[model samples]
Target: MNLLVRRLFWISFAVCGTVSLVWGHDVGEGDLKVTVLAKSSDAWDDKPLPHYPTGQPEITVLKIIIPEGKKTPLHFHSVINAAVLLKGEVDVHMPAGETKKLKAGESLIEVVDKAHWGENVGQGDAEFLVFYAGEKGEKITHVLHGDETPEAVLQEANR
Candidate 1:
C-alpha cells in the first residue's frame, strides 16, 4: 500500500510539472498575457469544437478582443477553425442563417464556406480565440459584404 501511494503521488506531481512547463514557461515577468473571453476552450460543451489541424508551414493561433457592443466586420475563415468565448456574450451572425448567442464558457465552430460577423452583446468586452490549421500567410477571411446586406432580417439582427 505504501509503495503504491508513493508511486501515485510522484506520477501526479510529474504530470503536473510537465504540463506547467509545456504550457507557458518561457514568458518573461513583464510579458503581458491577453485573455480572450470569447471562444475559450474552458467553455467547451460535451463535444469539443472540431480541430482542423493542417500540418503545414506553421500553426496559427489568433486572439481577438471585442469591446462592448462592437461587431466584427463580415468575413470568412479560410481554413478549418474553432472559436472559444472567453469572457463575455457574443452574438454571431451568419449569412443566409440566423444569429446565435454564445456566452462565456461556450465554443463555436464556424461554417467553412459561410461569412460570419460577431458582436459583443454583454455589458463587458468579449474575447475570442481562434485556431487555424493552415499556412502562416494564408488569409482566413474574405469579406463578402458589409453590414449593409439587403436581408431585412439580417439588418434587424445587426441592430
Candidate 2:
C-alpha cells in the first residue's frame, strides 16, 4: 500500500510539472492582444440606427479598392451600411459640407439615406471592406443626378 501511494504521488507531480512547463513557455517575442477601434450606440450622425427592413434579410459584404486621387459619385445607401478602412486613407464628404476622414485600421458607421461620397486622398490606393444590411430585393445604393441634393432625395423617398 505504501509503494502504491508513493508511485501515485510521483505520477501526479510529473503531470503537474509538465503542464506548468508548457504553460510558462514563451510562444512568441511579443504579447498578442486585441484592440477595439470603434464602438458606437448610434450612427456617425448621433442618430439611432435605422430599423431593418421587413422580409428576409439580405446581407452583402464588399471589398472596394479606390486608386489614389479618385472619388466616388454622390450616392446614398438605402440600407444600413458600415465600412472598415483596410489600407491607405479616405475622406467621406456629405452634401451638407460635413466631412469625415478615416485611415487604415479604422472603421465608420456610415450615414444611412444620406447622399455622400468617398475620396481617396492618400498617395496609395485606398481599400475598404463594406457591409450592407438590407432586405431581399431592395436596392442598396442610389446615385444622385446632377441637380439632385440629399434633401431632395430624402423628400422624394418620403413621398
Best by TM-score: 2
How well is each residue in 1-159 modelled by candidate 2, as lDDT tens digits? 454345334433432334444445566534543344555546677777766655666667789999999999999888877788999999999877888998998889888888889999998999998877666887788899998876687688778
Q: TM-score for all predictions?
A: 0.56, 0.72
lDDT of 1 at 92: 86
Tens digits of per-residue lDDT for model 1, 39-148: 33221222333343333333456788999989988876555556778889998886656777888877676655356688899988899877554445666666656454
- Which candidate tops lDDT? 2
Model 1 is weakest, by summed lDDT over 10 consecutive residues, at 37-46
Worst 10 residues of 2 by lDDT: 8-17
At residue 44, candidate 2 shows an lDDT of 74
The lDDT for every candidate, in the order shown, is 0.60, 0.75
Structure candidate 2, residue pairs in collision: none
TM-score of 2: 0.72
